[model samples]
Each structure stands twice: as C-alpha cells, then as structure tokens.
Target: MEAPQQTEKKRIKVGIPRALHFYRYFPFWKKLLEELDAEIVISPLTNKKIVEVGVTHGFGELCIPVKIYYGQLLRLVKDHPDLDFIFVPRYVSEVKDSYFCPKFLSLPDVIKILPGIPKILNFEVNVKEFPISTAAVELGKQLGKGQNKALNAYKEAQKYFDEYHAFLREGASVNQALRLVQIIRPFTLPKKKSEGDIRFLLLGHGYNIFDTFINLDFQKKLKDQGVNHITIENLPESIFKTPVIVNPRGAKLQNYWRHEEEIMQAIRYFLTKGRDEIDGVIFLISFACGPDSLIAELIMRDMKVVGLPFLEIIMDEHSGEAGLLTRVESFVEMIRRKKKGLTVGRRNKLTIKSA
Candidate 1:
C-alpha cells in the first residue's frame, strides 16, 4: 500500500499588542499560546508614528496608555493582516473587591470599533468569579484544544509566570526578565546600580514605567546619570500586599482599584520600614487618570509628613522630552543636595521638608 500522505496541522496565529498588561502578564500569555501550537505576533515597540496613530484614532477621554494600546492593535492589524485572531482579554478583577480601571474592563469592546481589525480572542479574567485557569481552558477550547491540554498549558504558563516575577524580585528590569525567560529577544541590558550614590522609589503602573518610548526613556536617563531607582515590581510581593493606613485619622482606606492599592501599599512600606533605603520617590502618573489623581494627593501628603522628597510627573500625549528631562534632572540634583546636607534654599522652591 502507498504510504498515506501526512496532513500538516495549521498553526493558529494570534496577535498580542505590546501595551498595558503585556508589561505585566506577557510571559504567561506567550507560554499558553505556544503550548496550544499558536504562533504569537507582538506589535513593535512604541514610537512616534505609533503614538500619532493611537492619538488620532483612540477616544478623546482615554488615557495615554489606552491610546497606545489602540495604536499597537492597529499596528498588528495593518502589518500582520493574516493574523488569525487578536488576543485581548477582559481583565475585570484580579482579587475580591478590587478591580481594574474602567478602560481595561471595556478594552475589548472599545478596540473592536477600529476598522479592519482581526477577530478578537477574548475571555473574562475575574478571579472573584472564577480562577484564571478556568478562563485559560476556555481560551484553549476556542483554539480547538482539549480540556486536559489546556489545563496543562495553564500549569506550564503559571510556572513560567512565577519564574518571570522571581527574576524581577531578583533585580531584573521587566525587559531583562522577559528576555531571560525567552519571551523577547535580547536587547541592550540596563546599567547596574552598584556604584550609584542615590536611590529613588519609582512608582507607576507597569505600562507607564516600562514603556521607554512613551516615558521618554526616563529609567535609562536615570541609570545614565548613575542614579539608582527601584520600582514597585522590584520589591517582594509581601511588602505591597500588606494593608496600608492612608490617613492619620486611622480611617483605613480600602482602595478598590488594584494597581492603586499596590502603589499605596508600596508607599506605606517605604514610609515605615524602607525609609532609609530610598532617597526620594518619583511618581509617574497619566494625565486625567481618576485613580491616579486621588492616589497622588494621598502620596504627596504621606511623603510630606515623613519629610521625604517626592516628585510627581504627569504624562500625556503632549508631554515633551525636554520638560521631562529638566524635571528629572532637577529632582535628582535636589535629592543629591538634600542627602549631602547642602542647602536647597527657598530660591529653588522645593517645598518638601528635608528628611
């Protein structure tokens, strides 16, 4: 008998935008898709053209990060026209009583308005209602995977995800960790902080903090200046998970927003236990972000009480590199002066009482 011709299995190609949650949960997504024999296509890094496209197309009231997300999705649609599906999970709530920002909840539906976009492979991720594995299994089923296969993929993805976070806790930048875990190709490694004289606690959502293009390469500039900084991601999970007392009235504020809660907890931890470790704080928040506005006021008040230097940089599409550089350079110099007991006089208008 003639040998039967072998049928080649068609690989599903899924596009993932390199924005927002990609900074946080990419490794898990990458692993899951790979296990299901899907070819993953990530949009290029943020650039001027991408920003312009996003701003032109995105809703007026949406924050810059969400706008950038729109840009990334459009890039995938325009550049990879043959993509089978675009993965845009609805991240409603990760923990009980705490939820993602409103934009995230509506992301999938909002992005569908863009013309010529590929089919969106979406699933709800509300840990309060069901485990992520349940969602992952359903996602796999959509890709024609068996329940056992999907569950196995989830287990593998979880393992890789934990390892990725472990790398972060060990002082790797998100890019570095992603590269180490083989999700992304190698790039120029970040400068080591071994000899830096000052340390700042950099606070922001991962999307804002890690996307160098949008943030105008803020972290790189700090590193180049030999100024060390730590982000909320670098700290151990236990520290940020601890509940925080946001005000002196002992009225424990339960922040319902997930990222804001982490930021608040991190600020509290630094204020109480890690006070000496950091010289100052640089909070990068998006313009017109409701949660950020509320949290920013509380952070400023808390930092003022502790007499720790704090600088809040508000970002939007119009944020210029020159202005950001000026502010960052001035903040670093001020911190250095404060640390050295050099007089930062009234002329400079730095109102934060020296620690």
Candidate 2:
C-alpha cells in the first residue's frame, strides 16, 4: 500500500480596499500580505460607478473620502467574491496626543456588520500603545500561521515601507514610487530644483489630492499649465516636527489628527521659510471633514496676512470637472501674471476666504 499523500496548503485570498489608507500605506500592506503567501486583490481605482455605490450606501453627512472608502469596499466584495479576508487597519494614535479621524477608527466596525462583506482582519496601528508586530501576530493566528513567521513578515513589511517613504522624500511622487522603479535611484537630500519653473505647493490628504478621479486629474492639470508642484508627502519627516507655524497667541494649534498636523505644518513652512520658492498654494479639501474645516480656516487666515495667492478648492461627490478646470486655469494665469510683474485686478482674484 502507498503512503498517504499530504494535502497542499490553500492560499488565502486577501482583499485590500484601494482608497484612503491604501494610497498612504499600500507598500506596507502589500509586502505583508505577500510575505504571508496570501493572494492579494487590491480594489480597482476610483471611478464613477464606485463613487455612486459609495454615495448610495454611505450616510449623506459623511466626508467624501469616507464615502469613497465605502464604495471601494463594496467594489472589493463585488469583484473578489471569494476573498477570505479584508485587511482594514484600525488606526488610533500614531503619536502622542494625535489621533486618526473618528471615522477611520470606526470603519472596520461599520463594515463588519454590513451584509455580504467578507471577514474583516483588523489590527491596531496605534504605535504608541502597541508593538508594530501586533497586527501580524494576530492575523497570523487567525490564518493558523506560526508567530515567528508573522513577526518576520512584519519586519520585512516595515523595511519596505521605510524605503518607500525614502523615495517620496527624495522627490518622487506617490504614483512614481508605486508604478515606476526601473529608473528610480535614491540619492542624498536637496534634490535638484527646476530653476525658473512655476512651482506651487498642493496641500491636502493623499486620498484627496492623489486620487485622479476624485480630484479630477489635479496633478496633470497643473503640469499641463507649465507648472510643477510638491505635496506634504514630498517633504522630509523633519519638517513636520519643527516648532514653527505657531499660533499667534503663543499657544500651539492643537491639531490632533496626524494628517491634519502634517498639512498645517507644511502650510506654515511654505508661508514662512519657503515663501520665495513657490508661486502660490492650492488647498484641496473634502467636504464635511471636521478636522479640515478647522485647519483650513487657520491656514486661510495666515495666508491672507502674508498676502500669498491662495485658492481652496472644495471637492465633493457633486464636483464638476469643467468648473474645476476653469478655476485652475484662472488661478494658474494669475500666478503667471504675478510672476511676470503683470497686474491682476481683484476682479479676477481666486480667494479662499469665500470658498
């Protein structure tokens, strides 16, 4: 009689929603899932149908990014019906006194109860409170994986994440880091500048500014107008930790949201230390963001005092591409005129105060 043959281990299909944190932390998650020998299925990019499904399923008052997230989740379920788990990291506090948005903290809970959704494998990302390997260990246990194997996977994931950010700090856009690596060569700080080229600092969350469909190809629009831009992600981590951008009253503006703090700090830097380098600033904010509402107000006030040419584009499900293109064209023209010492009357001005 022949000896019994051993059964092959089945690969678990892990679905990752391609919105929100996906844009911020895709490399980390992708590496981790790959290390676990799981088949990863990332949700498709944001599109019209996905936005409609998200708007229909999500609450009307929720922020646009959260609504888009819901749509991505729905799409993941529909596209990968056989996925064994959906990875949703429960982001709490990454730094002292700073918190993730309340919606992000509650996302997994909301999706868990939704009908037809796959099993949610969530782990706490509050680095101050838990070990970084906590998520890997817990998820490994659920998958019947050994703790040592999970810990090793976490280490490798972290290594890749650090390298990814290093590329970003070296002046590569998120899209470049994600898609183009053959020509990528990391070098020392102070990446070469584009002398005499029009530059502007585009400020917003990754999901808002980088999502092509949601932001309506914002980067391309700027590039088409003979402009170059940098975002919060392009700057070094040390910039955010600086003690500048202080409130007028000598009290720090206590922004507890991590992303919000970075945005505000970047604004403060550009307004003070970086004022001469960039032509102007464009702020893209999503509607119904509690944190952004307060931060934008503060930024707008400061920008006016310095008389920086500022434009805040408020985006939502109802945002129109034609209108956005027109606004951008006008703003770029104003900056060009200002650069060329040509007068731009107040009538053609783009003001964040009224936005």
Candidate 3:
C-alpha cells in the first residue's frame, strides 16, 4: 500500500512597526510571537523616505512620531505582501488614574484607513481593566492557539521583558538592551566613558530620544563634542517612586499622562540626589505634543529655581541639521565659558584675601 501524503505546518507571519512602543516593549512581543511559532517581520529603521511617506499620508494635526508610525505601517504592507497579520495594540491605561497619549489610544483605528493594509491584530492593553496576561491569551486565540499554551508563552515572554529592563538599568542604551535580549543584533557595544569635564542629562521619551532619524542623531553629536550624557531610559525604576512637588502651595501633583511621569521623575532625581553628577540638561520635544508642552514649562521653572542651565529643542519634519548643530555647539560653548569664569572668580578672590 502507498503511504498517505503528509503536509508541513504553515507558520503565521506577523509584522510589527518599528516606531513608538517598539522601543519600549519589543522584547516581549518578539518572544511571545516566537513562542507561538509565528514568523515576525519588523519594519526597517526610520529614514528620509519613511519620513516623507509618513508626512504625506498622515493627518496634518498628528505629532511626528505618529506620522512616522503611518509610514512604517505602509512600508510593512508594501514590503511584506504575504504578511498574515499586523500587530497594533491599543494602549489605554497602564496604571490606575493614568492614561497613555490619546494618539496611542486611537492608533489602530487611524491606520486602518491606509490602502492595501493586511489584517491587524488590534489588542487592547488596559492594565486597569484587565491584566496583560488576559490580553495575551485573547491574542493567541486569534492565531489559533489554546489558552494554556498562550499563558505559557506569556510567562516566557515576561522573562525576556524583565531582562531587557535589567539591561537598561545596567547602563545599556535602548538599542543595546534590545541586542542583549537577542531581539536585535546589530548594535555596537557601549564605549567606556572618558573623563569628560561636562555632562548633560538628556530628557525625552524613548521614541523621541532614541529614534536617530527623528532626533537628527542628537546623541552621536553630543559624544562627538566630547560631552557625556544620560537619557531618561538609563535611570532605574526605583527613582520614580518619589513624587515631584509641582505646585507652589506644597501640594504634590500626580501626572495624568503615564510616560510624562518618567520625565518628571528624572528631573526630580537630577535636581536632588544626582545634582552634582550633571552639569546641565537638554530636553528634546516634538512639535505640537500636548503633554510635553505642559511638562516643558514645569521643567524650565524647576531648572531656573536651581539656576541650572537648560536647553529645550523643539523638533518637527522641518527641523534642519545645520540649525541643530549650531544650537548644540553654542550651548556647549556657553556652559564651558560659565564654568571657566566661576573657577577664575574663585581663584581671584582667594588671591586677594591672601594678599
């Protein structure tokens, strides 16, 4: 008797856009999908072409990050025509009484308007309403997975997620941390720090601060100028537990926006415990970002009270490298001169008093 024919199992292909939350939660998604036996396709890094496409197709009022997300989605659709699904989760509230930006809440629906897009796996991630494990089980069901299998995958994924954060706490850049967790492979090992005379605390969202194309290679420029810097992602989670007093009436104000709370906590730490470590601060913000605009004002007021130098650079599609270079060079020069003047004044005072 002839043997019956056998068929190989087909793997489901899922595409993830390399924008926004990718910088924050990619490790978890990568591990989860792999555990479920799915093929993962990540969009390419941000480039000029992606920015142009995003700006053309995205809504006029949306921030640059959201616009770039559109561009990434289009690229995935165009490049991977055989993709089985695209993952675009709706992020509502991760904590009680705090929510993500409104843009994130509506991102999946917004991208559905794009032509020729594949099936989207739009999962709702509202920790206040349901745990992420529940969301994971539901997502797995859509991919034809059983509940017990999905829960097991989630537990494994959480291990990678925790390791990624631990790498960050050990002074790895976001890219480096991703590499450490085996999610990405092309990152350079971080260089040993030189004893640079000046240090700056770079405060911004992970999306804005780490996306090289959007920030115009801001971190590289700082290093090229022989200046050491730290970003918001480099700090540990323990610092955020202390509340920042934003009100002059001695009342503590809690931020309604979840991500903004990190920026606030970073400012509070630098101004108090880490004060002597940093010489100045440079804040990067996107144009028309509502939460950032309000937070920027508060940050400026706090910096002014302590008499620390602060530079706020507002970016958009129209932002130019020449202008950014000029501003950065000028800011660094000013800080250097101020430091020199203070040293000279102190020395002269000592000389006069001795004489």
Candidate 4:
C-alpha cells in the first residue's frame, strides 16, 4: 500500500501557526495560497498541551514561541491527514524601509526543529525588494504551476490580502480587547477608542513591547503625549482559520514569524497611509532576538528617510527609564521640527504662488 498519487489527491493544505502574528499576516498568506488554489489549515489557539508537545518536539532549550509552534504542528499533522506541503513564506522585510527580527530571518530552519514537522516551504517574499510577483512565480515553478496559472493565483491572493487589510486598518483596534479577538495569539487587542486622538504605532514583539515592567513608563509617556498606541494584543478574530486540538481549552498562540509579519503590517500602514496621522512609531525588540536584530538594524537605517520621526530601542530585563526617556524626548522633538519645516515649506510655496 504505497501513498496516493499527487493527481488523485484533493487540494493541498497550508498550515499557519497562530501564536505570533497569525492575526496580522493571515490575510496575505490566505489570499496568496488560495490564489494558488491551495486550502489552508491554521492551528488553533495555544494551550498547555500545545506547549507540552512543543517542548517535547523541540530540543531541550528552544524558545517559548518555537515550543508553542511545535504543539501547533503536532495538532495539524494529527487532524489534517489530507494536508500536503506546508506553506512557509520567508520574509526579510515587509516595506521598503523595514526588516523583521533576526530570528524571523531563520523561520524555515526553525520550523524544521519540530519532532515530526510538515515539509516546510521556502517561499520568501522580500516585499519591496523582491515583490509578490517574483515569489509567486518561484513557488509556482516549484509546485509545477504554469506561468499563467501561477500569475493568476498570485494576483487573486494579492487582491484578497489588500482588501482584507483595508478593512483591518479601517477598524483594527487590537491593543485593549485582547480576549475579544477569537484568534489564539499571544496578545489581544482592545476595541477602538473615540476619534480625534493622535494615533501612534508601537512596533515590537508582544512580550517586549507590552511588558510595561521592562520598558517602565513607556505607555505612561504615550498617554501623556495624548497618543493611542496599538500592538499585537489588539487584532480582530478573523485571522484564525486553523483550529487547535491541544488541551482543548483553545488558548490562542501565534507562529513567531506570523507576529513579525503583523508588526510589519502595522508599520507599513503607518508609514504609507497614516504617516501624517501616526505621530511616530516606537520599535521595541529584545536584545538577542536574531530576527529583530536585523529588523532593528534595517529600521535604524531607514527611519531617517521615513516620512515621520521614529525610535528604535533594545529592551532587556534591566533597562533604565532615564535613558529611554531621553531617546523618546529626542524623537518627539524631531517630529516637532519636521512639522515646523513642513509648515514653513508650505508657506513659502504659497508665497511664491501669490507673487
């Protein structure tokens, strides 16, 4: 009894872990794979067993996110026997000005660490540098898709992704309503507040950015600035399509890379459409996060050219509030200066027009 032939099987199922940013990037992957005409299987929320299986699957000392992903993979393999190759999209950066954590850069290798993980893929999308066209074409070639078929699939996926995110941006207040969103991710986003408030984007991993103890007065200062900031904790429930079977309690956990992508989305949204609306972005990642090490490196370089002023700070268990405050103050001052210049520039243009 050999395995069934590829031709006789149903649609291939692509699995996405929800621990990280499944809430954020699900739209992009869902549309892309569907355009490829593939079915999707996202693992359910995180639970104790998922964590248990994760620890068992990983080496003696993998990080928490990797452990949780192991559990998700276990659930996927056990339940979805019809699943084919898993779709893992490699991403160096989401925008022209950003790259995620150094850890994110090693997602393909990391997934392989699971005890009996699925055949992880290598469809890397250097969003600005490579673009979807190139990645879709390559994936099509690998999966035996013709040029036209692959192109069509990629287009549909892009359309779906773009449309879905449009809805999210219109109403993606994920910072406070963490439990409200049905997706089993690390954080939950609260619902939106009243309008007429300055919107700020705090870009970082759930643990680092949300951990007030580590940052000390980060949120307080944002409130003081009269800015409402959002993070991974504030996504809607629509991102989860993959159900989990661990512990059966239905705790939502995201794949680490997924979280990275979501952060990129938030950053991109602010940088492009909301540049003027978003006063600034504060990027926070742990000191040794390889994925974010690179992300921080790239953002540090590009923020200069980015429309608004931004700040990148590394966090550890022992961070000083004074130093952090100084950095934040400097960044705020820069924003003030840019606003003044824009005002002056506009006035000069008007004067010339009148003359």
**How close is every model to the real structure, measured as TM-score?**
0.91, 0.88, 0.90, 0.52
Instruction: Please write out the lDDT profile of model 1 over residues 107-210, one tens digit for every residue.
Output: 98988889898888976799999998899889998899999999999999888788777778878787677655554543344676377998889999889998
Query: What does candidate 2 score on TM?
Result: 0.88
Give the TM-score comparing model 1 with the true structure, all chains together. 0.91
Name the candidate, 1 or 4, with the larger lDDT value. 1
Please name the candidate that would achieve the greatest lDDT relative to the true structure. Answer: 1
Candidates by TM-score, descending order: 1, 3, 2, 4
Screening candidate 2 with a backbone cut-off below 3 angstroms (N, C-alpha, C), the clashing residue pairs are none
Model number with the top TM-score: 1
Q: Residue 181 error for model 2, in Å?
A: 8.1
Please give the distance, in angstroms, between residue 142's alpha carbon in candidate 2 and its true position after superposition: 2.3
Give the alpha-carbon lDDT of every model.
0.87, 0.82, 0.86, 0.61
Q: For every model in order, what is the number of clashing pairs?
A: 0, 0, 0, 40
Question: Tens digit of lDDT per residue, candidate 4, span 1-355?
Answer: 3467655667667777655445445656666676676767776656556667766766654455545556777777777766677666677765544465554567677777555566775687687677768888888776667888888887877775565545445555333323232343433234555542455667876545533444564777876755576654444334333322222355643324544545544554554555575777788765556666655554555556675666788765346788888887677766656655656555666534554
Off by more than 4 A, model 1: 1-6, 182-194, 245-251, 344-355
- Quote the lDDT for 264 in model 4: 49
lDDT of 1 at 66: 94
Q: Ten-residue segment with the worst summed lDDT in candidate 4?
A: 239-248
